[model samples]
Target: MENKSEEKGITRRGFFQRILVGFGLIISAGATGAIASQLLKSLMPSGWFGEPYVYRKVYAAPITEINQVGASIIFEDKANNRKAILINNGGNIQAFSLVCTHLGCQVFWEKERGKFLCPCHTAVFAADGSVESGPPEKSLDQYPVEIKDGLVYISFREPTWQPEQYFRGEGL
Candidate 1:
């Protein structure tokens, strides 16, 4: 008696091998599709994403200007359009960016609680700009402080925003 598989020239082993080849092709096709999608996304234009700040050492204010301790004085860099807080904790001066890491809301220095509090999401940060407890995964950005010749110097970064310009007759 002649078996049907042998008569058709497709043995059981060949059938299994064909199934495995089909499965491998399907898997490879899916992987190729995922890679192609990621490449397309990367080529898209980035909208509303601003450039990183060019960090540098700049004078914030005079040491004598921040008279009170434990409290913070908000100062703005008109040239760079950046805002930061100057702290005088009993003659230990420190500066931190007002921008919260979680969101863009300004973080406040809670004198009584002795920490920075973000009123928007109830995020808390320590006096040293470390994250205490909050939804924010990262700590607040701190500025390096130095006092020279009765002057307060803070080394911080400031972003340089550029306007969108139409190029190749597009982005109109």
Candidate 2:
């Protein structure tokens, strides 16, 4: 057989076709990466609210009346430690960390705004601890609160940036 190379020399057409294939591959890979990134972001937990800690006491004011207008109440935990606000907005009773998720700034209830407000950056949160506006990319970590025997209970896991197995109910 004569040198096959003579007939099979890479032509401009072949070269252009190969370039197109490579470009297509690159674009496909980039799209896949973007999709994966979005999926991971959606799957990852933004933060952790610690375990439930219940407080049993007869409040000077009803839980409904106190938190109805968005007031932060400091109540003693089972361990008698001073903790953040325990809010009861109408039918929803949610306990959120007063500390801002962004920079540890104290967040407070603004009845006028109908949400929690962070003065440092004007971050606002709905009654359910979801970020309404501002720089916060994640919602507030929510603790499981239950009402038992006319008392309020708050449950939360410690705050964490990196996800841990314990937080995912792996060993929990």
Candidate 3:
């Protein structure tokens, strides 16, 4: 065996040395991968992959088109999986979440009654989101409304920072 290895130019010592070097390279590669993963994680922005709640413009309608007071317009936010009601009350525009506070049922805009009525439990919320009747103890959730450039933009989430102009309507 010794003569055969010597003829092949590979000694027992060299074989063990190559095995150790192979293990060292494997260990170094693992360490390098770990370091790179940590570096990438630190460099990435916070909440980049997380579901951070953000105030997004859910509905936009021209002010001139909203002409009727006490009339409610329903806007569904598919991105946030929620619904909102935009009401023009005496020229003052306001928005409220359509999810009933009592049992999370979808509430309907009762234009005749001038309130949001949840048919699930008969919970009634006034146009101002105040509780009118039924099992609901708290008022309906109100979203912030911004009127910019003759357009009404409604946001369902509370913004962490100042939101940029969402509705840019040159002809609208």
Per-residue lDDT of model 1, residues 58-110, tens digit only:
77787678867775677786645667888877767888887889987888888
- Alpha carbon lDDT of residue 47, candidate 1? 28
What lDDT tens digits, residue by residue, belong to model 3 across residues 112-167?
87978899998888889999999999898888999888888998774342223233
Q: Could you tell me the TM-score of candidate 3?
A: 0.57
Q: What is the lDDT of every predicted structure here?
A: 0.78, 0.66, 0.78
For model 2, the stretches where C-alpha displacement exceeds 4 angstroms are: 1-82, 156-172
Superposed on all Cα atoms, the candidates' RMSDs to the truth, in angstroms, are 6.6, 9.9, 10.6
TM-score of each: 0.57, 0.47, 0.57
Q: Mark the regions of model 1 whose C-alpha exceeds 4 Å error after superposition.
A: 1-52, 67-71, 160-172
lDDT computed for candidate 1: 0.78
TM-score ranking, best first: 3, 1, 2
Question: Clashing pairs in model 1?
Answer: none
